[model samples]
Structures are given as C-alpha cells and as structure tokens.
Target: MVAPALILVILVTLWPVAQSFYNSLFDYRLTDPSRSERFTQSNIDLERYATEYFYISRDLEDLSAQAPDDETAQAVNDIQTEIEAFHSELIEMDGLEEQYGEVDEMIASFTAISDRDLKYAEVDNDWAEGYKDFLAASNEELIALSEGAPEEDFSTTAGNVAGTLDTINSAVIESNFIGLSNYSRYLQDARMWQSLLNTFIFTIASVAVELVLGLAIAILINRVFIGRGVVRASVLIPWAIPTAVAAMMWGFLYDGQTGIVAHYFEQFGLINDASVLLSTANGGMFSVIFADVWKTTPYMALLLLAGLQTIPGSLYEAAEVDGAGKWQQFWKVTLPLLKSAILVALLFRTLDAFRVFDLIYVLTGGGPANSTESISIYAYITLFSQQNFGAGSVLSVIVFLCVALISTLFIKFIGSDLFEGRSR
Candidate 1:
C-alpha cells in the first residue's frame, strides 16, 4: 500500500520536477534544425521574411528613381546597404545549416558537460568558439551578396544560415548557466532585481489589502440585513468578472488620454497627469497594484465569507450570553473557530497573488520602467520576448519554489489537522 502511494507521489509531483532538472543540465533548443530535417518546411516566418525583403528591395528601387539630390542618394544608399547586409546574411546562413547539421563536435561538448566530463569553460567557451567559427563563415557570405541578390535563392538559404545563428543563441544560453555566473549575472542584472523587488512589494501590499478588505466585506455580508441576497450578488460582481476582462476594463479606465482613473487622479491633484500616472515608475506600480486589488478583492472576500458561514451561530450566541459584546464575540468565538477556514483561504489567495501575471500583463505590460513586473510576467518576457530559455527555466524553478515555500509555511501555521483527510 505504501509502495503504491509513494510511486504515485513520485509520478505526479517528483517526475516533472526531475525532468526540469534533467533538461537544465543540457543546453539545447526545442526546435533546433540540428535536430530536424524539416526546419524549412515548418517555418512559415522564414518564407514571410523572404517575401518582405523582396518587396522592401523593390520599394527601395522605386524610391531611388525619385531621388532629387546627393543627400537623397546617400539616404537611399544607407537603406540599401542595410538591406543588402540582410541579403548576404541569409545566403551564408545556408552553409551554417550544413555545418551544424548533426554537429558531433558541439554535441560532444554538451554531452561531456552532461556527463561531467568537461569543465565550464570547455563546454561553454570552447564549443561556443567552434560554433562561432561556422557562424563567421555564414556572416562572410552575407558580406558577399550584391545588389543583384536573388530573393528566391534566399528562402532555401536562410534556413541554412539560421543554423549558425541558432548555435550562437545556444552558446549565449550555455554561458548564462554553466557556473555561478548566472547568480553573479542575476546580482548585476538591474532589471532582474528591480522586477524581483517590485514583485515582492506587489505581493505584500496586494495580499494585505485583499485580506483587510475581504474580511470587512465577508463580515458585512454574513449578517442578517435588508437586501442580503442582492447585496451578496452585487459584492460578488467584481469576482465573477474574469481577470483578463477586468484588467482590460481597468486598462481603458486608466488609459493615458481618455482614462477615468487618469482623469480622476488628475482632477483631484492625486496625479500630475494621465501620462505621468502610467509612465512614472512609482505611479505605474501603484496603478497596477490598485487595479489587481480592485479586480481580485472580491475573490478573497468570497473565500472568507465561506469560512465565516461555517462558524456555527451557537458559538457566537454562547459568547453573547457570557457577556461578550459583538466585537468581543467576533474576536474570541468567531475568529477562533474560523481560523482554519481563514488559513485555507489565505493560503490559496496568497499563492495566486504571488503568481499574478494577467492583470499586470494587461494593465501595464511590466513597463513604465518594469516597476510592475511580477515574476510570472518576468518569466514570460524571458521565455517569449527575450527568448532566453535557460534564464527562463531558472526563473520558472524560482517561482515554483517561492510558492511552495509560502504554502508550506502557511499550512504549518494552520496545522496538519486541516489536511488529515488527504494522503500523500
């Protein structure tokens, strides 16, 4: 019985974690042409760029026909020079494809690191240097393309040259990972620290605001009052609205030119102007956090309200009989009994808030100087925008660990009885 339970835990929880670790050991691309013969076949963007370059070249030719002076001639020449460089780069990229196609030497470098047979420098620099030489060959070809460079010829060639570019990208990643370098890099990395600090500040303030406001709303809704049913629904309106939709709603309201938030803050002298609110570092963070709190406060309230309802009325009545006033009864009887429920709610909401991405993503896009960048948004920018896979993987691990640590600590405070029914 224990064997089956242990196996289940390993499969469900441990395996994927182990796989992330496994992958972290190797520097590889998910879609490296070195791994596939179908790069040109699958890449729609390659063909699209090729077409775009063709059109751009033609547009330049047409513009050149209308040049009125030496200055105009020089400007056209500058633009064409850049375009021609692109053309040459594409042609040379084909040889890069052929070179790294199942590059055993580079693979040996990565494999040696995986097996602990090579030092950091050997795997990172030496192998990367090997890749760079091939890439240089690709760059040289790009240098050779003339004004008569054929666009059709490049569709096939870009896929080839792209292989070397891919290798260079991989090398940049391996350099980030191999030693205590990333830690040093992380320390020196202003953007990373700023984002990390902002995330912490947002997490703390948002969690605090949600809990205080949520408890007040939950207590109010729990009582017998007029329009109780209608009031409950009204209170939940914010929660019922999807986060993305709410974020967008707030985005419009906070829009620089025609936004209500910007207008109000400006009218009341709370902000200097609409652009200032969204563009200033402190104001941007404040706006993002406020928007998140507005959208999600009701969610926290609903959780607390559920816990409040489960507290038996009898306890409060007994407290009243014992000469406890409403406040005292709330403090001694209701609060004590509802501690478990509150803990459960807080645990869920805190974890969710720590991973906040969408609201910040929509409302601010981690900008006006990245003051509102949550870890989730940071991970996204790394993975998708920067396309730095190694750093992104490291960030994913960090996010998971932070959330897990928070949950563990919170659960410990509430005690194991809360989870007694659930087995590992």
Candidate 2:
C-alpha cells in the first residue's frame, strides 16, 4: 500500500519540476512563430516560408522591370535567378514540391493554413543553415543596391525587397534548444538578485512577527475564560478573509491621504509621513510586512493553539505543585512540549510567506521601483506579462529550489528528532 502511495506522491510532486526544468532549457515564446515550439531538429515553417517566397518572387520580377539601367536590371535579375535556384532545391528536397505547391495555393487564396503536417516539415540541417546564410547576405546586397540606385523611385522597391527577404529568413525555424543559457544569464542579473533579496527579507520579517504574536495568542486563549469560543472565533477573522480581499482592504487603509491607519502612523512618527508608506521603497516594504503580519498571525496562533492543547494539563498542574510559578511552568513545561509544533508552524508559514504573490501583487504590484518585488511576482511578470518563457522558467526553478532548501533545513535541524521519536 505504501509503495503505491509513494509512487503517486513522486509523480504528482516531481513531474512539474521536471517539465519546468526541460522548458527552461529552450528559448520558447508565444509571440515568435518560429520559436513558439521547441524543435529538436532543423525544420521549416513551410506555410509561412512558401507564402514569403511567393511574394518575394513576384516582387523581384517587378523590380527587374523597374530598374533604370541595363547594369541594374541585370543585377536584379541575377538575384531573382539565385532565389529561383534556391526555391527549386528546397522544393525538390525529399519530394516537398507537392506540399510547397499546396501551401502556395493556400496563400494565394488568402486561406488560413490549419494543417500541422503541411505547416512544419523537417529539412536537412546543413541545407537550412546555408539557406539562412544566403538570405542574410542577400539582404545586405539588396540594401547596398537600394542605397546606390540611380533612381530614387526604384530605391523604395529595392528596400521593400530587402524587407521581404528578412521575413523569409525568419520563417526558417531553427532549434530553440539553448540548454542552461537562460539560467546563466539570470544568475548574473542584478534584478534577479534584488528580487530574491526582497523575498527573503519579507519572508523572515513576516514569519518572525507571526511566530511571536501567534504564540502569545495561543497562550492567552489556552486559559479558562468565560467566552473562550467567541474570543477564539473573533481571533480568526483576519486569517479567514480571502488574501486578495484582505490586500484590497489593506490598500485602502494604507492610502496616503484619508486612510485611518496611515494617518495614525504618520502622527506617531512611525513613518516619515502618511504618503510615504505606499510610495517609497523602505515604506513600501514596511507596509507589506505589516499587512502580512496582521493577516497571517492568526493562522500561526491557530496552529500553535493545537500544539498547546496537546500538552497534558496534568503536567502543568504537577509543575505548579512543585512551586513553579505560572511563568516558570510555561517556560519549563509549555515551551519544551511545543517544540515540534513550533517547528511545524514555522515550516508552513515560511513556505507560504516565501511564495507570496497575490497579497503583495494587489497591495503594491511590486511598484515604486520594484523595491518590494517578490521572486514569485517577478516570475509572474516574466512568464505572462513579458511572454519570456525561458527566463521565466529560470525564476520558477529558483523558487522551487529555495522552497526545497527551506523545507530541508527545517526538517534537518528541527523536525529530525520529532520524526525519530514518532518512529520509535
């Protein structure tokens, strides 16, 4: 039973990490048609290439006719002849003439090509490289011809011809498999480092405050009280609210002018002024940390409360009988008994605080100079906003590694004995 369960766990947990790591190896993006797919071999986007080729051939014939001098007309005709030769070679390779003709007709009729088999076809790697080199050289030659053309009106046509060659050049999809380049570039990026630093600072500050406040609340509620249930329920209101909603509420409270919370803080000199809280770098970081502490402290208290409940009441009574004061009883009995719970709470909160996105995203949008940007927010912007999948996956893999490291540290230093004792 455990073996099957373990296999399922591995599948669910590690599969996405594996997939992300694989994607990080490629230069994948949605905007670039040639690089949209991860190609393992040299290939051509035949539909796009054929369409471009058809236009280039027609334009070249018109350019040859429009030339001002015999020398210029012969030069234009030479380029046309070379393009025809290349086209013949391309279509004849592995009998692609039928597919090429079909794609050409599709373009002529202004029909959208939907068939994958007709769109992408594998080509010899050497042939593809040579063709790309020729296209680049041809573009340069066309630019020179346009600049030196005796007729200014004909220069525009030559420039158009060069531009069309560029489109055809881009249609040849090369392999986007650039293993580890994205990671290497990001490792040296200062923005990446700064985002990581901001994340660590936020995580440590919020988790530390939450731990202390949570422990205190747990102790307070553990005693006999007249309305314990009501107090307990009230304590959880902040934590129970949806994180985005809480963030929005905090945003209003942090507003510079009319916000009650910011006004009071300004009066107390806790900040330089009311507006600075959400507008300045240090103030922004402080506002996010304070908001996070307020929202998540109750969750920490709940976790610690469970641990507090499990401490046998008889032990505290025994400590009291031995002349131990309430403070001493807590120090000697409660603290020792709650070690495992504290460790577990820290592990969960630290992980949650590290991956924080929605709270900070809604609150600050990592704005005012990206001073409060977390790694996850940075990843979100990179992956979705910028549409740079290769770079985005690098940030994602880094976040995963950081989470795994935090988990490992907690288990090794604090959770080892707890698990060992349970096993025994």
Candidate 3:
C-alpha cells in the first residue's frame, strides 16, 4: 500500500524536476534553430544539407566551366571534389543513406521533409569538424577569387557560391550539451544574485509581519464575542480573493495618480508623494510586501486559531488562579502549547512566500527596476519570455533547493520538539 502511494508521489513530483535537470545540462533554446532540441553528438540537418548541396554542386560545376584562368578553374573543381567526398561519407553512415535520399527526393519534388529522423542524422565528430573547416577555407578562397575575377557576372556568381558554402557549413549542428556550464554561468550572474536577494527580503519581511499580525488576530477572535462568527468570516475575505485578482486590485490602489489608497498613504505621511509607491525601488518593495501581508495574514490567523482551540481552557484558568496576569498566562501557557502550530504555519507561509510569482508579477511586475523581482519571476521570464530553457531550469532548481533547505530547518526544529516530548 505504501509502495503504490510512494511510487505515485515520485512520478508526479520528481519526474518533472528530473526532466528540468536534464534540460539544464544542454544549451537548449527554442529561438535558435540549431539548438531547439537536445543533441549529445554532432548531426547533419539532412533537409537543409541535401537542398543546399544540390544547388551548390550545380553552381560549382558552372563556376569551373566559367573560370577566368586554369588556376581558378582547378581550385573550383578541387573544392567541389572535396565537398562531394565529404557528402559521400555522410550518406554512407548507418541509417542515413535512406533518409538522405528521401530528403533529396522531397527537395526535388518541392515537398517538405517533416519527419525529424529524415531531417537530422548523426555524424562522427571528427568528420563534422573536418567538413566545417574545409568549407570555411573554401569559402575564403572563393571570396578572394571573386574579388580578383575580371568578369562582373563571374564575380557575382562566385560570391553567391561562397555564401552557399557558408550556409552548408552551418547545417552541421555541433553538440549543444554544455553539462554544468549553465549553472556555473548563472552562479556569477549579478542579476541572478540580486533577484535572489529580493526574494529573500520579500519572504522574510512578509512572513514575519504576517506571523505577528496573525497571532494577534487569532487571539482576538478566540475570545467569546457576540459577533465572533461574522468577525472571523470577514477577516478571511482578503485571503479568499484570488491572488491575481487581489494583486490587480492592489495595482489600482497603489497607482500613483487618482488612487484612493495612495492618497490616504500620502496624507498619513507614509510617503512623500503618492506616485512614489509605483515609481521607486524601495517603494515597490514595500508595496508588494504590504499587499502580500494584507492578503495572507488572515490565512495565518486561521491556522493559528485552530491551534489556539486545541489548548484546554483549564490551563488558562489554572494560570489565572495562580494570580498570573493575561500577559503572564499567554507567555507561560499559550505560547508553549502553540509552538507546533506556529512552526507549521511558518513553514507553509515561508515556502509560499519564497516561491511568490503571480502576486509580485501582477502587482509590481518586479519593477521600478526589479527591486521586488523574486527568483520565480526571474525564472518565468528566462524560460518563457527569453525562451532560454537551460538557464531557466537552473533558476528553478535553485528555488527548489532554497525551499528544501527552509523545510529541512523547520522540520528539524519540529522533530526535535516531538522527540523531546516523547522522551519526557
């Protein structure tokens, strides 16, 4: 029974992370044609190679016949022979001849080779290197010949052939596997470090404020009152709002001009100007933290309220009978019993706060110069906006590590308390 559930957990949780880790090992980017997929060895894009080779072969044959001198004609013929020799070797590779023939036929018929296996073929690393070097040298020679050729048409044709050779060289895709270089690159990236610092600041500040306010609110609601149910329900309204919706609503409230909340803040002297809220780095950070605290404090209060109810009323009564005042009773009885609940609440909130994305994304958009950019937001931009999967995955793995570390520390504290209780 446990095995089945554990297997499910691994499949659902670990599989995606493993896939991301694998992607991080390559220089994967969707925007670049050559690096759109993960390749561990050099390969030829048969579709592009076959099409360009057909035209290049014909052009080279024409150039040799039209050469201005015997030396030029011989150079053209030799370049064509070397290219054909490399091509012959390429098509002879295992399982490539059939695909190459198909691609050639497709090109002749003006049909696209849509199958990936028919469009790309693995080639030996040494062969690819030699082919690329030969093409580069041949292109330079053709360019030099074109510049010195007397006939204008011959000069133009030679330059065009040289351009074709360069294109063919690019068809030889090298391995994109960079191993751990993406991780190392980002380790020195200043933006990555700054974004991480912003994330930590937001998490620590928001969680700390929420904990204090939440505890006070929970204590207030726990006492008997005529409208306690209404009060408790009303307190949850902010948390009940969808985070994106809340963030958008706060966006309006924080607007520099024509915003009621901003006006009130200015009147309260919290800021020198209403526009400063959305236009300055420090102000942007404060705005996000404040909005987060308002939206999440009720959640924190609810969790603590549950823990507060678990404490027997007799304990408080006993403390009072011993002449302990309210503060003394709270410190002696309420706090000690509430340790586990507080830790649990802190764990949940800290993890959630550290991974914050939508709230800050919609609120400040990590702006006023990215003063409030969290690591998650940075990853989202790199992964989606920039289409850089390798670097984005590194950021994602970093977030997972940070969250794991925080959870480990909190669990250790909770576990030690449990062990001590059991021993007692």
Candidate 4:
C-alpha cells in the first residue's frame, strides 16, 4: 500500500545519495578549467608514482656518467636491468589498478562526458583513439627505459612527460569508468562546508520563528469567539500565497528606497536610516526568516488547530470545574492534548525550512555574497552553477542524510505516529 511512495523515496532520495558519494571521490567537475585536469588530479598519486619511476630511471643515467670504464658498460647493463624491473613494477601497478584502482578509467569517463555526450556515448570512437595514443606512449616509455635509452630521448622533458601520462590516465570514457576518485576530491574542498553552515543557520532560525508564531495564533483562535472563521481564513492567506509570488512580494518590500516595509520600519525607529533589509548580512538573514514565518505559520497553525480539536471540550470544562483558571487549563490540558499535532507541525515546518530555496533566491539570491546560501542552494550551485558534478553530489548526499536523520529523530522523539506508526 505505502510501498510505492517508500520506493519513490528510496529512488529519489537514497539513490541520489549513493550516486553523490560515488561522484565525490572523482574530480568530475563539468566546468573546471581542466575538465581533464580534474581527472588528472583524481589519479594524481598514481601518476606521480609512475613519474617517480621515470625520475629514478633518469637518476640512474646520472649515476652512469660517474661509473668506472669496465663497470660503465656494466652500469649501462645494470640500468637496463633495473629499468626492466621498473617496467615490471609498472605492469604490476597497472594490474593493481585493474584490480584496485580505476584512476585512468575514472578520468576518461569525465573527459568523455559533457552536455554534448550522453552517458556511454554514441560510438566512443574519440576515446578509443585517445586511449590508443595514451597506451602507445605508455608502452613506448616502458620500452625505451628498459632498452637503456637515455631519458632525454623522449619527445618531452621528464617533468612535462608525466602530464602526458596524466592525460592518458584521466580518459574516463563511459565504457571504461570505474573507481571512487571524484568523491575523494569533493572532501578536499572548503567552499562546501561554508555553504553547509549557511544552510543550517537559515533553516534553524526560520523554523523557530514559524513554530512560535504558529502556536500562538492557534491558541488565540482555539477559544470560542465570533468572526473566528474570518480570522482563521485570514491566517491562511499567507499559506495560500504561492511561495514564489510571496518571495517576490517580500523582495519588493525589502527594497531600500521605495519599499513600504522600509518606510514603516524607519518611521517606527526600528533602524536609523537603513531603507532595505536584504542588503546587509544580518538584515538579509532576518528578512528571509521573517518572510518564511509569514508564509508558513498558517500551515503550522492549521496542524495545531487540528490537534486542538481532538482535545475533548469536556477536559477543559472539568479543568474549569476543578478551579483551574484559563492559563491553567491551557497549560495542564490543552498543551498535553496538542502534543501530537505540535510535533507534526514542527516536523513539517522543520523539513521545509531546511530545504528552503525559492524565497531565499527571490529575496537574496544567496547574496550580498553567498551569506544566505542554504544547503539546497549550494547543491544547486554544485550541480549546475559550478558544474562540479562530483562535489555537488557530495553536498547533495550530505543534505539527504541530514534530512533523513532529522526526520528519523523527530519521529522517534516527537512524531512517533507520523511516518510509520499507527493506532492499533
């Protein structure tokens, strides 16, 4: 019965997470200057190792110059022998890569992909050509070294030669793709953590304001009163507004010179001469939270109202009969009865707050300098803006896990009947 949604959740949520973690290991940025360089970085260590072997081969040439006459030829022979051993080691390393590393394959996969190519490209003919060249060069180097050819015989210098090797290693065409290199690169970046912290601040402040205002309004309307229906309907106006539209409305209101919000706040002495709220960091934060609270509080109120309705009217009557005052009845009876609803409201609002984007975008655009960048916004940036698919995936996967953990914790502590539990 609930299987489809659960399956969909797993597909949409969990599957993406697994994919992101996989990507974070690779340097799979779509827009990086070295789209190929990212792949090179992914295999940096392996490439370095191979180059180290080359350098050692070169150093033996240095040692050859100082050799005594009889042994100089023997030294040449010894260098040849050592070079063969190095080639054997390189082959063993490649075998290990086949069994344990996919640096080359992973790099190829990134280079072979773009907006132009779909997954596992049409013919992969280009990659094949590139692969053949790379392999030939790799084999040529090994052959030359083993043949006791001086390192200077190669077309490129020893230092520059490794870069050519890197180019070959990073040819991660779709067919040859394997390894977790992109994701490892994601962990090394600093901007990701900054965006994460920004998101946390926005979500927490927004949810707190919504919960407090919502509960207050719910209690206000819970009592018997004329025009209560009108009041209740009024409360829903903010919730009824499309989030995008409301975001625009707030954007205008937060405008410095012409905004009514600025005019009124200044008139009331809330600020000295500041005319806009979204320009400053603290102001932008406050504005977004304010807008969020205005839009979502009614939703929180409605959920709490539903819970308020379930409390038998008789419980309040009895509390009054037992000499409990209005505040006493509310504290002793209303709050307890409303626990389930409160939790439900909080869970919904909290999750929504964590994922918030449209409002921040319309209102702040995650600026005056990325101050308001939430995790969701950062994920968007990583995925689309920066085009670092792997890094974006890592951030996205982290968000998924955090949301899942929050939902799970809320259900265990306050929402026991929310996700899976039911009355027997």
Predicted structure with the largest TM-score when compared to the true one:
3
Off by over 4 Å in 3: 1-12, 416-424
Candidate 2's residue-wise lDDT over 168-243, tens digit each?
8888877888989999999999999999999999999999999999999889878787987787777689888898
Summarize candidate 1's per-residue lDDT along 22-119 as a digit string, tens digits: 43433324444332111211111222233334455555554444444566446555555654664464345535333332233445454422321121
Q: After superposition, how far is residue 37 of candidate 4 from its true place, in Å?
A: 13
Residue 227 Cα positional deviation in candidate 1, in Å, after optimal superposition:
3.5
Candidate 1 TM-score to native: 0.63
Estimate, for each residue in 45-162, the C-alpha lDDT of model 3 and write its tens digit: 9888988998998999999999998999999999999999998988788878887888888899999877887788899999999999999999999999999999998899999999
Write down the TM-score for model 2. 0.88
Residues 175-206, candidate 4: write the lDDT tens digits.
32335544465456666666677778877887
Rank candidates, TM-score, best first. Answer: 3, 2, 4, 1
Q: Weakest 10 consecutive residues, lDDT, candidate 2?
A: 415-424
TM-score for every candidate vs. truth? 0.63, 0.88, 0.94, 0.66
lDDT of each: 0.64, 0.89, 0.92, 0.65
Candidates in descending lDDT order = 3, 2, 4, 1
Superposed Cα deviation of residue 315, candidate 4 (Å): 1.1
Give the clash count for model 3: 0
